[model samples]
Target chain A: MQIVVDLNRCQGYAQCAFLAPQVFELHGEEALMFTPAVPDDQRERVHRAAAACPVQAIVVGERAGPGVR
Target chain B: MQPDTLFQRITDYANRADPYPLYAELRENGVTRQDDGSYLVGTYHEIAALLHDPRISSDYRSRTHPDEAMIRRNERPPSFIGLDDPEHDRLRRIAMRPFGPPHSPGRIDELHGDITRIAEELIDAFRGADRIDIVDEFAYPLPVTVICRLLGVPHEDVPRIRAWTNAIIDSFDFTPGADQEKRQQAGLDARDAMARYLGELAGGRRGHPSEDMLSALVNDAGPEGRLTDVELMATATLLLIAGHETTVNLITNGVLTLLRHPDAHKRLRDEPGLMPRAVEELLRYEPPVHMLPQRTPLADIEVAGVTVPKGAPLILMLASGNRDPLRFDDPDRFDPEREDNQHFGFGSGIHNCFGAPLARLETQIALGALLPYLDDFHLLDDPPPYRRSPLLRGPRHLLIARG
Candidate 1:
């Protein structure tokens, strides 16, 4: 599954990173870096991370198409 | 029994120990409008959505009938917690710089050793003691000391700071009584005095540049520019208080809940790996801050099919939402291994608890250290004395005896 983070909306609360550290990593206080393509092993964690995002900044699956940044 | 007084009764000191049943009633009522012109939301989905809603303002000044005492006390501008973005986001970002990732990635993790050591020291003091008050001796001092060291404030100042914090917290009491004015004044006075004290401490850190948050904030010169003297004072005061207050409740509540559920306590002691998840459960089951008492709506918002007008006091019952049956399976049960636990313990959205990482580590260490002794622990008070403020809810003292 593909993932996209609306960086503008992401306040870097790091809930995503905390839940799915392999898929999402916070570079600094506010800069969040993530793996767009979810790995098989991390799919469950990514889903949990998406749900836990405070700002709902993370979009996953079919809705998270290209150019949605 | 008018439904409007639900919020009032919930805040009443009598229900302080266990407000869950009332919360269930509140969830059944949906979004309720109180007689005092405030709105109380207790449902899980509604509270979660409202937390993420931009229409919901955290600023108390936005209320139609803003507290005059609060207005006067906040003459120096409200802290970022009380401000809306882009202002809140800006100040919060600047403040986050020296404390967490990506600016200072290891800041909180680095404190793990210190936190463990501190927890051990506090527990060590309980040696040869037949009984102890966890709040005064263990829970309270642990977080306060950690926060002080992190902020570069001298540990000796805690007693004075504690007075200021107590007065400030007492001001948050929702009940209107004859002493309301006096309590508000004390809170305002405490805030001002605390601000002045914090400001002086930050001022001393300028150019000296110690390895502390206060010094980092004081010496900061990033692209976002510096927090003005007043802003610095407000921010410093916010950090100090926020860092100190809530975590105490988290730790104390953990102990209380553990003692109450001996089975869970035994499970934790046997399988210490569950400590982190247990902490999360404690947050959901018995959170520190029960309600967000000072939120306002920017526009007429439809919450749970109720049209809440703008400028109305919006009290989000966080602890209630934590126990909403619709949100969790067997919501009342304390399951350490519970998965997908996205709790309102630290709240959500932009105003989420800033000190969460540190608070979590501190609690884990604090409780993990106490696990060995909990087997012999006997609660001296089943329903321990709770603090006055319903917002930052927790026992004021948890008395226990060790066999």
Candidate 2:
């Protein structure tokens, strides 16, 4: 699975970091550092983080998860 | 049909405990223009969309003044929350530096130990009481102490701060025809006094730095940062008030909601891991903030098919959006495991609640620590007395007896 956060739109709410700390890390207040892709194990939380974003700044799919249509 | 009257009723102090039904009605009617010429939006998606829309303005400068003199007298340099970008974005960035990701990434996370300790201490203080006021005893003190410490304010100053907080909150009453002159004056006085004190405190940190957020604001520097004395005063007051005031309601409301619903309470007690999701549900089901009416439309805005003209107030009934059935299944039900709960308990978008992470942590810890005592507790006053402010809604005093 692939994950992306539009750094421009990201206001550093840290909802992503809270929900999926393994996949995303927030540096200071302005910088959001994250893994672009994650193994299937972290898929659920990453998706949850994407949906939880107040700005919808997170994008989660260049590659679909296994068995996901 | 009178759409604006519904807003009046919702803001009415009488309906504070259960304004959800009124909000449902607003959603049903679609976007409503109040008799005051402002607009009220209660639908979930619409509220969410408007919150993110850059066209909408949180700047108070945009509002059509009821009294030009009063607005001028009452207005101070707005904290970033009330400003539009790039100004809002700039101040928020500086404020966020010490509080959140990147530079101080682990700041709030590190407060876990301190906050948990505060919650535990507050709970332990409840050991010998037969009956207790949750607001005065448990919910209020925990956040007050945490915020005081966070801002480098002396804990002994809480009484003074509380007085100011009360006055400020009273000035913010949204009920129609509420007395304004005295309360607004008091609020301005309190704000001035608070700003002066915080300014002095921040000044001290300039040469001799401390570990608190105020210290960071004064001493810390970056390419995009540094707040002037006026900005610092406004920002400090905003943080101090914003940090504790809403959080007190959250903890108080969480306890009240849980005690009302024992099955859910028991579930939370049994599975402590569910605290995060449960806290989110508490926020959705019974949010601290029922309405934020300050956002004015910058231009003619169409919401749910109604046109809200420029310069009119746009009341975003955030609490209403939380219960909108379009947003959540079984919207009114307080399910601890409610998924995809992107609640407006904390306002959404750039203006989303900055203290959300801390607030969530406090509520989680607060509910976790208090759950044991609540296990053997019963409500002494059902539908407890609520505070007068409609913006921040919670029981004024939740009396509970351990039997």
Candidate 3:
């Protein structure tokens, strides 16, 4: 799975960072860093983090399983 | 037929108890133009779109009138919430440093225990009283005490905090012909008082570091990311006000709503696991912030096919949008087991509420503490008296009697 955060759209809510700390990291005041690829274990959290973003800035790709769309 | 004077009616103090019907009327008309030539966007999708639109500006400088520029210019430095991006984004990031992730990843999460203890302490006092004013005795104090501890402000100074907060909030009315100068003066005076008070506390924390946010803000960081004295004061004052004011309403409104809907109240008590989503539902059904003031369009913006001309003032009716039937099934009814409950309660886009995590934690803990008491308690006043500020809507006094 892949994670994409629209940085311009991000308001630094940091909610995503809290929900999926493994995938997302916040630097100083102006920067937000996160891993692009989501591991199998981190996928659930990444999705929750995306849903938790107040601005809806986090976008995640399709699920890992065979049932995925 | 057009919706005549509906905006005014919605804002009128008389309708403070309930404005959902008027909001429904507004949605029916799509994006609406009020008598003042400004617009009120009431639908869920339209409000959400405008909130994310770059053409939409939160800065008061984009306003057309002469008095607006003068009033906003003369005031103390604008809070990040009132400014557009680059500046807004920068200040918000700086402000978030001590409160949220990367630097202090566990800050808000750590407060969960403190919040629960605080809620429990306040709720414990209700055991002896024949009747309790929930606003004064419980709901108001819980968040105020929590914010005071977080900001490193002395808990003894809450009276002054209340006075200054009231003055600052009173000055924010955007109704066409409200008394601007007196309110502005009051707001400035309050700002000065709070700045001087918090500055002294922050100044002491400069050399000796502490665990609180004020200490981190004052002692830590390079000159580049550091907030200037004025900016610090403005940011601190904004946090002080923004931190507690709305949360008080959310908790109080949550209790009131739950009491009104007995089944939801009982359900919450039985299934404690539902607290998080229940709190979100409370936010949607009776949100603390009803009307967000003054978003100016940098260019002519089309909302729901209605052309909002450049420089026109648009009021984003957040509470109205939360109840749009087009967005939710049976929007008027309160349901704790709501799905896809992406609400405008904390707002959307860049200016979305910075203190939301803490607010949610505070509300979740607060309602948990109050739910048991409410099983046997009832509201003294069915539609209790409301605070004067329509923008920050809640009961001024929620009297509860033991049954």
Candidate 4:
């Protein structure tokens, strides 16, 4: 399983960046600076980073899901 | 005598501001039992263990649940936190669906803007005031409004519900010789009244869908289907109470703590990016939900060789765990940059805080926004007087002067 963040809804709390910076990246404005996807080897980091998102905008799986909006 | 016991004192008002010492005393051992037959567990490891134990029920309907007479007089089944599985599992699932898939990504990301907007509005109210009581002025309205908006509760009813919410929380105190009956009844009246109020509010959304949790619960067709009338009321009660009460304390504690610890306050102001970790540290150092609902030991439970007999009460001090020197270096130090901080601010295991993500976001935003503003402020008291309930710990009023 991998992680995917919908940039459209991301407000840049950077919680993902804080929890698993190895996989998730936070820009200066707090939005995703890089891709949220993680390799299978980094699934643990991806899962934790996903869990860390307060808005629950991070999706974890082989595929990305629809946006809340 | 265990110093953790709050049996002494001419007034129980001292409980609100800081229950940390009592927690420290309780942390000195496995568990201490009060004369009233209630127990207190302040050790983080022990609390974590009990929180994870299935036998330790959070539900009042459980065999070892708190007596109805012990709870507020007229409230229906207690909050979802005070509930056992099956029902707890059912309601928690529905309550959480719209929020997120438990540990999934942040779906509430869109609300960040709205939350910021709300925070700004509340701050607007604080602009000209010379002295601000954190409770009445800032912390209180922030979370209360957020919950109201989240649950779709009408803002007009907030005052009434807020009163009921206070009454319900007041009833949970375990202070010796305290009139539990009066507080409990007030809590009961608050619950029924709030339930009736929320029930009416939710009624209109039955056929009509709204973008709120209540609407989601009302229309939920998940594995458990929609919430029952009773369950719906209970869920609303939980959201309104849990949504604000715990968070308000957390936000207030964060501000008051900063005002007292000017250095930490300065560091946060200089480095606004650290607000996230600061929020975590604040949670550990001064958590909102101080003690959890009572837990009854099943059969015989042994912790580090001491056996807690069946039916014995156990209280888990999560905040104390955050300060445990065994787990954290200088556990009491309010360091926002403190690494490896796996504090139990939101409890842990299955019943961990469902709204933790939202709560964290709110605090980070509120604190991050307010840090610069509070930099010039000073605490009027070394330790401001606390609220009455040990369960919901925080200052009743924190006076800060920017001048």
Scored against the native two-chain complex, candidate 3 gets a DockQ of 0.24
Candidate 1 structure quality by residue, lDDT tens digits, B1-403: 4334888788888889999999999999889888878899998899989998998998878889987765776676799999999999889888988887656666776686899999889888986789999999999999999999999999999999999999999898877789989999899889999999989999988889989999999897677888999999899899999997999999999989999898999999898867877888888999999999889999999998899999998999999999999988999999988876878999998899988877877888899998897788789998999999989988999999977
Q: lDDT rank, highest first?
A: 1, 2, 3, 4
lDDT score, candidate 1, position B282: 89
Report how far residue B305 has shifted in candidate 4, in Å.
1.4
Give the per-residue lDDT of model 2 (tens digit) for B1-403.
3334877888788888788888889999899877777788998999999998998998877877533433754378878877899999899888877886655656765676898898888778878888889999989999999999988999999999999999988877755454666777788898899999899988988978889999999888877769999999999999999999999999988988898898999998898867877888888899998887778888888887778888888889999999999989999899988866778999888888888877877888888888888877888988899998888888889999988
Docking class of 3: acceptable
Roughly what TM-score does model 3 have, to 2 decimal places?
0.88
lDDT of predicted model 3: 0.82
TM-score for each candidate, following the candidate numbering: 0.89, 0.90, 0.88, 0.82
Relative to the true structure, candidate 4 reaches a TM of 0.82
Where is model 3 more than 4 Å wrong at Cα?
A: A1-13, A19-69, B1-4, B66-74, B174-181, B222-224
Worst 10 residues of 3 chain A by lDDT: A60-69
**Residue B131 miss distance in model 2 (angstroms):** 0.8
Count of clashing residue pairs in every prediction: 5, 7, 0, 22
Candidate 2 local lDDT, A1-69, one digit each (tens) = 897677787776787776566678966555788988787878766765675576667767866444433
Candidate numbers, best TM-score first, in rank order: 2, 1, 3, 4
Runs of candidate 4 with Cα error greater than 4 angstroms are A1-69, B1-12, B36-38, B61-68, B71-75, B102-106, B177-179
Prediction 1: B-chain TM-score:
0.98
Q: What is candidate 2's local distance difference test score?
A: 0.83
User: Chain A alone, model 4, TM-score?
Assistant: 0.71
